[model samples]
Target: MKTLINFAVILFFAIAFNGIAYSNDECSFNGIDDVLYFQENSISNLREITVEACVKVNSFSARKSGANEIWQFIIFKKNQLDHFNEGFAIYLDEKNERFATSVASAKGIQAVIVDKKHSVELGRWYRLRMSANSKEIKFFVDGVLVKSAPTGFPLDFDSEELFIGGRTKILKDKDFEGRFCGSIKNIKIWSKVLDEDD
Candidate 1:
């Protein structure tokens, strides 16, 4: 009996360490969306996802242009926004630049801010996801569709080193200048497209 318990514990750790697929009973990665997933309960009162889970992201579809762009909650480098060069972006503009979408503007949200610290509805627990598909880039907040990027967005990513809550400094000379402050969890990623229902 003791051996059985030990085996079970070892198996659990092994699977987790190897990034095993989740059981059908649990949430699976959505391929149609083809986006990054980050959830946190402490920050939004739902689930808490650590920012360290996703550090490097170059290509995302929030495909928007102009003063307003899509806003996908991501755990990017905190200091990346200090100079507003290019930190982990949700709604990309052309190649790999994340821009503010109109949806955020219409909702009265800037969607993009360069600072050492920022907070939203603390204790609400939020789930943020973003991805790039054949059509356009997409973004979701709390599992609810928030916005999409402008049509005809190029599907090209330049960065490679991906980090949770941190963005790469490839497109621009900007780096994270602030300490990422948030909870991140349940990180699942794939190199394929995700379905809407996924």
Candidate 2:
């Protein structure tokens, strides 16, 4: 009788532990080629959006031109790479040694690049958040606001997909120029602009 009771207790604990592990696994992204693509209907329009993720920068490299940096995370229109008419990207600028964010639209590209001195260190985990609406756009690192700017044009969400850990083309092309070497987890997306307190 005692053995039966002990066996039941162990089984209960095992099931509980497995549930916790599975929950964590749902949000984690590992490897240089890790990406999560969303179906068009899976996500709502991107007019006002918030993207948050916990990232550990394993490495950083400049793109082919060496002028534009590699984006670590991007919400982009399919098949539109360099001249994306509607999209947003967060990247590490090796040349300037700073973290940067860019929001592009048919109107123009509005970039909020941190100064060279505010570069993020490698092999450290940091919470990166970006919120945008028609009025403005904001970037945050480690729960602190790093950059903010006015945003007049709304993001185009038609046929959009989310790219994590690295850009889409770089993953397929095996191009190290704009590839991200890192681990990303706990990615959350919202259809509405999130407040500072959120």
Per-residue lDDT for 87-106 in model 2, tens only? 66666665555566666665
**Model 2 ranges with Cα > 4 A deviation:** 1-36, 40-44, 62-86, 115-118, 169-177
- Model 1 residue 72 CA deviation in Å: 12
Runs in model 1 lying further than 4 Å from the true structure: 1-73, 76-119, 168-178
State every prediction's TM-score relative to the real structure: 0.39, 0.68
Q: Of the candidates shown, which would achieve the greatest TM-score relative to the real structure?
A: 2
lDDT (Cα, tens digit) per residue for candidate 1, span 1-198: 011011223324433643433342222212112222222112221111111122222233322222323333343312112243322343223222332221121112223322112323322344555544334445555555555554232232212333332232222223322212233444444333343346
Clashes of 1: 58
TM-score of 2: 0.68
